[model samples]
Target: MTQINRRDFIKLTGASAALVAVPSVLKAEIGSAYEARVVVVGGGFAGATLAKYLCLWGDANIQVTMIDKNPNHVSCILSNLILNDRLNMNDITLPYTSLQDNYGVIVRQGLVTDVTGDDVKIVHLDDGDTITCDYVVLAPGIEFIDVPGLKEGAANNFDVVPHAWIAGPQTELLRDQLHSMQQGDTFVMTVPQSPYRCPPGPYERACVVADYIKRVNDGDGHVIVLDPHPEVTIEKETFEQAFNGIYKDIVNYVPNATLQSIEINPGEKIAKTTAGDYAGKVLNVIPTHKSGKIVEDLGLLPVGARFAPVDSASYESTIRPGIFIIGDANDSGQPKSGHMANSQAKVGADAIIRMIASKSSSVDFVHDPARLEKIRTNSACYSPITYDEASFLTAVFAYETTNNSMKLVQDSFASSNSPHWNKDNFEDMFIWSESLFSNSFT
Candidate 1:
């Protein structure tokens, strides 16, 4: 992967001038002549942020419409708190009402069935409705695949074992199960392979659940974290400190525990993995992830592909001409997290606006250095290691001219310093999440 460090980025793009000044330059032209019809599908961070920016940055001349299956987006950002009773479901639930009332975005609720077009695409909804637009931004978050051992016709069947990866009804189910754990009881959860949504998410969930059990159940029960990988994926030192230092007794760290199948017996759910057979009162099997079915159905992905490839600068599909894929669905070499999605949305929104202003395809827009120089994206998220303590991870990504893809800036990766989790970081976690929530939703 081609990359540029902070020092080299400054050498090439003049740091602040390239990242900051170009927005002001683009805003002047975006407000007047760009009368474009853009349709954004999915209401998660990427779609919501994209739509909000499109309306916020573009003037009345730009007409933006958003479509989602749900009336509101229940954020997976901090949904883990729901399990530990630190935060309620309502706290993380984001509504589209503000996008409609505050911004002049047309919010439509329906399932997108099909999208067909070349330059201008027509989006078909399950309700038998069609919307033709000048551009389409697809932000369908992710779809869970079937793990081995599940019964036939039971794929994504959360009734038996609540994955709860996507925050919604299943999240409540898992929350209830976690809350009901009594002394000496066990709670088991699995971590899928890398490139999973929210790299540190499974580890964070283990930490939070362990903390809750210890604090609530008088440190009797244990939380088993079964991981397929040999070690933690992200925030290595911090999570190691958490699992080994504070919550060691409460958390059982089982490495290289690959899920083979599921076994259900009398009043027990067992995860039969390569490590061993471990049973729990409640089992959350986060299956492998893939781009939502829409992207596959639209033939945007290569055969046997998991993520749709896109030009990182513009987030437009390399397979298709006009459709732009953002968030977890696209292969941008970025961690799949809400904050990352939100960051990509800004760059994508700006790219779309610029394309609309210039009447250029995303391929051309990504190639044009003058236009590409205006691109920059940063993704960061704070993980709550405990109820009142948290850890953070951050990275900067920029379009590299050599590779023509988004690459992590060398020496830009930063995490919580020594004693990674503390009270201040925990408090700042909310402030950070609130800022992201407001910027994307409100």
Candidate 2:
């Protein structure tokens, strides 16, 4: 069997030695020019960040192009707050014009059909257009694979089970269902296993929904979270406090509860779970996911649909060079969140710049052999534990460095009681959103 190593592959490309000596900024400029065009597919968190950074900091010589199926993107990060009426959808939705106006990025509103190394051949509205480049960044996010019996109209049931994790229509559907529920009604939320986007999302959704039920229905409606993990990975202390003190009577959190299968009858508005059968006015089933289908189709992913394995530091796919994967699509052990995606985007953008510069110059840039041996990759997630209070939690993990990998680092949890907490968090949320929006779209 032929063996391929990340470091060996980088060196064999003949650009590795030049990459080590080239500065990131200069490399980016060279790659952004016509000579070193860069095509970034998927205008979500990862793609947008990569495009913007490459344009702003990359060598001016490179021409950066960003492509996506949609012109406007609604963020998955803040969509959960919409369920509790904490935020509106419009606040999170952003248009692509900012990328064109603010940054010199060429925006292509189309679907990516295929990705070859250094060449992204796409089909736009049934018309084909191929863009050749020095590097291709694949950040198409994730797609929920249709399970055997978990798809719309799969079992002759018109009833819909919304996985609001994807944002947009599915999110609106879940919100509508929640609002339509009567008092004393029940809602079941299922959390998928590890390696999914937003490790804290399912728990955060439960908290927000429970808060809504307490306010509107006076603790009449019930929320049961069926978690596959042994314990919640985020805000555990704060969540426990919220559940015990605020929604103690309303929410039932059942850990180690996995979904065996589902029995849905649309006519009767009924569903059955492994834990027990319940007739709820609404049901939210967030199933397992894999890299977006396009990744697999382009032969960028490995055998299993779990994730795209890549060089740990650079995020360049092991299967192909000149192709990078970030966000929820990559096999990095980090929690799949917009924050981490942005971080990884920076690393990927820098790596691509180095690779391009090496190719242009005669210098032999040695790739870092120890780049993948880093100690920690951490992400912080903030969840509203109460109507006027929220908790900031951070999870840290040592990837490929230690056997006992996962570690939880608890940040300060601020309640509404603290005047400073509310003020700071409110300002922080807005600034974070604006920063991301400005960096990506603007």
Candidate 3:
């Protein structure tokens, strides 16, 4: 790991001189006198990253509190592999104890029933306690969009077709269905519309599941993908190439096909789709999504009712002051992924630190306007396609300071055949998970 100096960090900002400021250290006693409390909602990738970075980089004058409904988080990033049995759910599930023990962050297991700019009130199911904070970070993840017939199925015939997008029981139900399928039976996968979490996740699931079926069922099973998007962003060519060249006999890819309704035949143990009535032994439906219900209940989203609009520069909600939204919940052009969410959290943390520092009288005289101007830009690096099971293509985008339009700096494909993909990438993931857990719960 390279040590990130303040100068290098500033350069990464892409901001003008107006944003950079000298790092200051305050005595513990002085810091405690005016410590600002930060409350983070949702313990997923974005919320956890922001909370961790704030405690790691911000002044000691800041106290962090993280609130979440679940005590442990199972990452959606790698959950697709779990469906194929490539990875177990334990590999992605992380507890909050590490965050509490390591970072000294106050972690409360509660649901944020309501949120305002200055204070957030959470309802603790364990003991019915309400906790409030000064600054709140909202990263409650996303809620599935109610596709009319889809909800009807979920309420009634959930055993036949399952939307395993959310972790826990839904995931296990889908996995069990796949395991129970006959060797020659068909399996159907439906990809949701754009702006969903992990653009390549559905495709990845298809690949991994196909690989599993080929290995176990001796290439007797068939897998079909129904994509709502006209084309996939990641590995479109490569995926087509693989499907045509290697998995041609077993895998079928259909694009621009919207799934209107799901007709489950319990007698035949099959599912029907909009393209045609195809019988399948198992069905996995990835539905359209919006900001989670908690966020909607808190009235954080805009009039569109899709995502919460925020200033791209700060990730601060336009509708609510002092409340920041990151990850899939925010209406940013960036693809919703754990990697992008982590990057945005760092930027949000830095902005909050700058905002807090600007209020101090001692820093007023020494504040350099030139440096402050330089701290406004943020960038994101996304790995959209995984070439094989190991590596893929990535896009690096930088946000313009004035307009916030994303500029592609590097959009190229890369392969990682080395064992380091598992070694280094897994290590990085654990570090990220630990940091988030600590920040949110400690």
Candidate 4:
């Protein structure tokens, strides 16, 4: 693998200084004895990247504490490979050791229960501990909205069926279930509404599952995709070609097929859904999302919104100052994918560091001409059409000062042509992912 320097990393993420403006005066150059504390909740791509960049860019006066309930984060970036047996859990799991040992970031293992503050922020963890900070970043990723008739912890429940969206034991369980498929068995999966984790994820899963079934069962197997949206949400032409041409015989694409409920019996190896229930041998249901419990519990979400609304340039909560929300939990218009989250983290980290250096608690600094000049974030996704061929999409979101929201730059949107999947794109996927994984974790 070629070693990617910081500049290459920024370019690959599409968040270079030219694309996304940095404050004229950064924190590292403005050294001060005034210590500022930043407590980041959750250890996924967003939070971990924020913690890492904050430490790397901020001066010694900036102290960061990262808290995640789990010891390590299993990445959802390359998780689709789990279904095809192309990769295992270890390939995607990232630990926080480097953040603590190398960057002096304080890593804590605990669940945060509540957050309260007036000028400063106070985080209450479930373990009877409290964290006080000048700035609080909530990168808690996302939590799934429960569907009717499906219980998370019930015996032989969804876990047995496995969404595997978060990438962990559920991923392994779903992988094992796929392996047990018979020659003519069926694999059924549901796609949540748009604005879910990754737009191309469900279609990717469908393609890989169909590919696996075709390879193992001699093209006798079947795969079904039940999407609630009216059509493919992203990379429309690319996935349409894959479904209608490449794997047309084995793959069934159903749009506007919303999932209302589910019934499963592991013993019979059967599952049912409201969208014309079938006795598929395996089932995967990706659920709708809400901001993490920490955000909801703190009343950070706007009234009737599933995610916390934030300033696009700074990523600071529009409703709550001094509290920033990055990643999937924020209501930023960006896609809730790992790569996009990492991009948002950089923007958030820079804004936070600049805020502290100026000793300003309010996010009004985001409006300064220098700060607002070229705020943008890039989102790129690679969808595997088969085990060896893939297609990709890229979009750049620039902050519009008028409405104070991020909008897709018309000229910055591009995707691989339909029916153009190839080995080179597939190989580039690994290289891109390796760069992302290394940049975020280590």
lDDT tens string, model 4, 1-442? 1233322443565333123434334643456646689999998988998898888878567899999999999999889998788987889989899998888889999999988877877899998899998888999988777676665422336666688888889899899999998988888888987688888889988989988988888888888888888888877777888889878998988887888777766543333444576558888878888898889888998777899999888899888788899999998888888888888998898888778877877788657876676677877677888989887766778878899888888767666663457776788788778778887888
**lDDT leader:** 1
Give TM-scores for every candidate, taking all chains together and pairing residue i with residue i. Answer: 0.93, 0.81, 0.79, 0.92
> lDDT of each structure?
0.82, 0.66, 0.63, 0.80
Model 2 agreement with the true structure over 338-374: per-residue lDDT tens digits: 7667666766766666566556321113134343333
Q: Tally clashes: model 1.
A: 0
Q: Count the backbone clashes (under 3 Å) in each candidate.
A: 0, 18, 26, 0
The alpha-carbon root-mean-square deviation between model 1 and the true structure, to one decimal in Å, is 4.2
Please list the residue runs of candidate 2 whose C-alpha ends up more than 4 Å from where it truly belongs after superposition: 1-34, 117-127, 152-159, 266-274, 360-366, 369-378, 395-427
Candidates 1 and 2, the one with greater lDDT: 1
Rank ordering of all candidates by lDDT, starting from the highest: 1, 4, 2, 3
Q: Mind giving the per-residue lDDT tens digits that candidate 3 earns over 304-367?
A: 6688887666777877667788877888777776656766776677667655655532222222
Q: Residue 310 CA error for candidate 3 (Å)?
A: 0.8
Q: Estimate the lDDT of model 4.
A: 0.80
Candidate 1 — which residues are off by over 4 angstroms?
1-22, 29-31, 149-155
Cα error, candidate 3, residue 245 (Å): 1.8
Candidate 4 positional error at 193, Å: 0.8
